[model samples]
Target: MDIQKDQILETRVRLELDAKDLRNYAKKATGYSFALEDIAEHLESTVELLKSIEKLKSQEEQDQYQIGQQVVYVDEFMPDTVEIITSIVDGWVSFNNGSRGCIAVMIRPANQDEIKANKRLMVA
Candidate 1:
C-alpha cells in the first residue's frame, strides 16, 4: 500500500473513534495504555490551535497591521523575530525592541503587495 494512503486511512479510522474507543485501540495496538482524558485533552488542544491558526489566516487576509498586534518576521540567516506593534504613524510602523529599556525600532509598513513580492516579511 502507498504510505501516504495508508496514513490517510489510519487518520480517518482514528478520527471516527471516541475517546474511550481510542484509548482501548491504542492499548491493543501498542500494548501501552493511555488515559482517555489525556487523549481528549490533547485532541482539544490541537483543535484549539488549528482554530487559532485559522483566525490568524483570516486576519492576515484582511490587514497585517494593527496597533498592539504581535507578528513574527521570517529571516533567512537567523531565527524568526517576534515583535509587538508599538506605534504607527503615516506609513511607518514601530515595533518594540523586545528588550528591557530599549527604544522601539521604526520601519515602513509592508502591505500585502510588498509581502507578496518579498516573502521574508510575514504577519503571524
Candidate 2:
C-alpha cells in the first residue's frame, strides 16, 4: 500500500514532524513489509540503520498514535499548543481551553475551498 507522508504518524517524533512511523503494533499484527532487503534495493540508506530503526520501533511496541501524543509535524497543520485531540466533528477539532481562548473553530479540510471564519475572536 502506498503511504502518504503526511498521514504517517509516530508514537514519538521530533519538532514539526510530518513523517510516518511504519511499525507493527503487536505480535499478532501484520508486520510492515519494509525489510532490509527492500530498503537496500529501493532506498539510499544502509541496511544497518534500517535494522536499527526497525529494532527500536519494535522494541517500543507502540500503538496507533494520537494527534497530540508525539505528533509528526506537518507544517500546514502544526498547532503550537499540544494537547490530546479531544474531538473532531464536521472537520472542526475541539481543544480544551486552548491558546487565544479558542474553544470553537470552523472546520478546514484539505480538499475543496476549505476556509474558516474566526467566530470566537471577540471584538473589543
Candidate 3:
C-alpha cells in the first residue's frame, strides 16, 4: 500500500487498541462492558476537537503580533519613538534600536498617527 494508506491503517489500529484498553478499564472500574465501537467513536471525535483547538491557538498567536512591524512605546516618556518590532512573547514585545541595541516593550498595537509621530520624532 501507499504511504497514506499505511499511515491510516496504523492510526486505525492504534485507535482500536486504545478503545479496547478503555473498555477494559471501564469494565473493571464499574463492572460493566462498554461497547468498543462507541469508545472508538468518542476517541475519534476528541482527536478532531483537539486538532481544531490547536489550529485556533496557532492563528491567535499569529494575530497577536508580527516581526519587522513598526510600533510605538505607550509611555509618556518616549511616546514618540518609533520602534521596530523584533520579537514577541507572552506579554511583551522586543524591539531593535535604530543602531545596535534592543529593548522590550508591552505588547500593544499602536495607531497610525502614533507610528507616524514616532517616525517624525526620530528624524528630528
Candidate 4:
C-alpha cells in the first residue's frame, strides 16, 4: 500500500518535535529513564488525570546539555542549567503562576492580515 504524502510529512515533523521535547524532559529528571516504548505508551494516552500528575517526561533533556553558555532560559530553582537566553526586548511571552505564588507576565501579540498560523506539516 502507498503512504499518504501529507501524513508522512506531518509524522516526520511530529516525531522530531516529540524527540526534542522528551529529551529536554529527560535531562531535567534524576537517575535513569524508562524505555522508549513505555514513553510512547504514556504519550499516546490522553487522560486528564495524567495531565495533572506531571511526572518527569524524559531523562535526556536534563543530563544531555553542555553547561557553558548554551542554555536559553530556566527558573533559578532548577538544577542542571546549561544556558540562558533573553529576547533582548524583542520578544513577548505570556506566563501564569497558576495556584502557586510565582510571579508571571502576560503578552498580547498583533499580526498582519497576511500572516499564517503555525502547522507541523512541513515538506522536506
Candidate 5:
C-alpha cells in the first residue's frame, strides 16, 4: 500500500531514533544475547528502505520555482503570507523567513495579484 511521503519520513525518523536507543541499550546490557543488536540493525535497514521510498519533488516541480520566486505560505496558525523562495533543499521549499515544508500543501507559487498586493503593502 502507498503511504504518504511525510508519514514515511516521520516514521523513518522515529524508527531511527528508536534504533539508536536500542543500540545504546545493547551496549549497556551485560550478558545479553545479540538479539537486541540484530533488531536494531533491522530497524536501521528498514529506515534505509523508507528513505528510498520517500518521494522528493519532481524535476518539473523544481523547475517551476526559483530562489527569488514569490510564494504564498499558509499554516494552521496564520493567514497566507507572501514570501520569497530562498532555497530548495532536497525538493523542499525554503522561505526567506527560514521556514520550509511540503510545497503546494503549505506553500504555493504566489500569483501576480498576490505579489502585487504584497508590494503595495510594503510601500504603504
Candidate 6:
C-alpha cells in the first residue's frame, strides 16, 4: 500500500510540474493563462485526501486485533469458530484453537455473543 501510495504521489508531483511549465508557455504565447494552476491545486488536495484515507485505514486495521485477543476464524470448513491470536507479523495474523494449535487463518474480532458461545463448549 505504501509503495502504491508513493508511486501515486510521485506521478501527481510530475503532473503538477508539467502543468506549471505549460502555464508559463501559454501565458507567453497567448497573453492569457490556462487553469493549470487550479488543476495543480486540485491535484495537491487529492493527494492529501488520499494520504488521509490511507492513514485512517491503517489505524483501523491496527485497532482491529492484538496479541492474545480472541477472534472468530471463518473459513469454508469452520465458519465463526473462535480462536485466540498468538501473533501478528507483516499484516499476517496467527491464531490457535486449543486443538488446532497455532495456525494462521482468516479471522475477525470475536463479538461478545460469539465469545460467550465459545465458552459454553466442552472438551468431552
Single out the weakest 10-residue window by summed lDDT for candidate 5: 115-124
lDDT of 1 by residue, 1-124 (tens): 3233234445544544554466666667643444655775576555555555544544443354676655444334532344556764433445664331112222324455544554335432
RMSD of each: 14.8, 15.6, 12.3, 19.4, 6.7, 8.6
Candidate 6: which pairs clash?
Answer: none
User: Where does model 1 exceed 4 Å of error?
Assistant: 1-34, 64-124
Model 5: per-residue Cα lDDT over 15-66, one tens digit each? 9999999999999888773888999999999999887776442444566788
Best by the lDDT measure:
5
Could you give the candidate ranking by lDDT, starting with the highest? 5, 6, 3, 1, 4, 2
Q: After superposition, how far is residue 57 of candidate 5 from its true place, in Å?
A: 6.9
Give one digit per residue, the lDDT tens place, for model 6 in 1-124.
Answer: 3444446557656765766676576567552444655665675677566667655555555567888887765554455467777766544566653334333335556777778887313221
RMSD of 3: 12.3
Model 2 lDDT tens row, 21-124: 22222222354454533433333233334445545443332223323431212233444323344443333344552322221221222211111231212211
What TM-score would candidate 3 get against the native?
0.40
lDDT of 4: 0.32
How does model 1 score by TM-score?
Answer: 0.28
The candidates, ranked best first by TM-score, are: 5, 6, 3, 1, 4, 2
At residue 59, candidate 3 shows an lDDT of: 53
TM-score of 4: 0.27
Whole-model alpha-carbon lDDT for candidate 1: 0.47
lDDT, model 2: 0.31
Per TM-score, the best of the predicted structures is 5
